[model samples]
Target: MLKPSTLNNKLRVLLIEDDTIEVMKLKRAIAKLEMPHEIVEAKNGEEALDILRNRDSLPDLILLDLNMPRINGLEFLKILKNDEVMRFLPVVILTTSSNRKDMLECYKEGVAGYILKPLKYDDYVEKISTTLNYWSSNELIKG
Candidate 1:
């Protein structure tokens, strides 16, 4: 089990991914870990943008995948970074892509962290748990 953060506060996370399995894996991991964080899912960049635009309460963290159907992760990152209000929101690249170019670009585009998805279910869970635990300890800005 993952250790609880010092703040012990729940986080509203925006998870933008096109893969159904990936989404399910994350949800399952969260459930298994018994985290209290709220996850808001978006199938792609377009849908994520719509959610960001319309939602009254924005998410504290965004877990983005690089490859998607429409408006890929890089494009979405550009758009999000350009938005004055949304730019401050911490976005972490949670993707399968291990390409150095992609990693560098995401960092350039201002992602908080870049993580490659593990093939093993247990590893995946551990990575997600660690990431969440680290972020939860930080003083995240509420947007």
Candidate 2:
């Protein structure tokens, strides 16, 4: 079991994914890890932006999907990077897209990490666990 405090001062996550099935699976994986986290969900990048802009408490990390309705991931990343208040927040591109151009673009825009969504449930769980562990171990979570 991974202890959230061991990785950083605080643990919170904002996930922007449009797929309901994927969201359910992700929630199950998070539950299995028993890691302390305040998970916030958004159906698309537009909703995510609204939340980030209005919410008083910002998340330590954001897991974003590239393909979404109403403001895609790349557009959201651009807006976030430009904002003085939001630019510092770490963002990880979590999506199914394996396009080289997309990868390069995201890196250029300052994404902390990029992860391809796995097809299998177990594989997906492992990926999520590893990502969480890596961030925690690296102390990437904001205070």
**Candidate 1 wrong stretches, greater than 4 Å:** 141-143
Candidate 2 clash figure, as a count: 0
| Alpha-carbon lDDT, every model | 0.91, 0.85
Report the lDDT of model 2 for residue 87. 96
Q: Which candidate number maximizes TM-score?
A: 1
Clashing residue pairs in candidate 2, if any? Answer: none
Predicted candidate 1 versus true structure: per-residue lDDT over 1-143, tens digit per residue: 57565565688999999999899999999999888899999999999999999657899899999999989999999999999899999999999899999999999999999999999999999999999887776766432
lDDT of 1: 0.91
Error of 1 at 96 (Å): 0.8
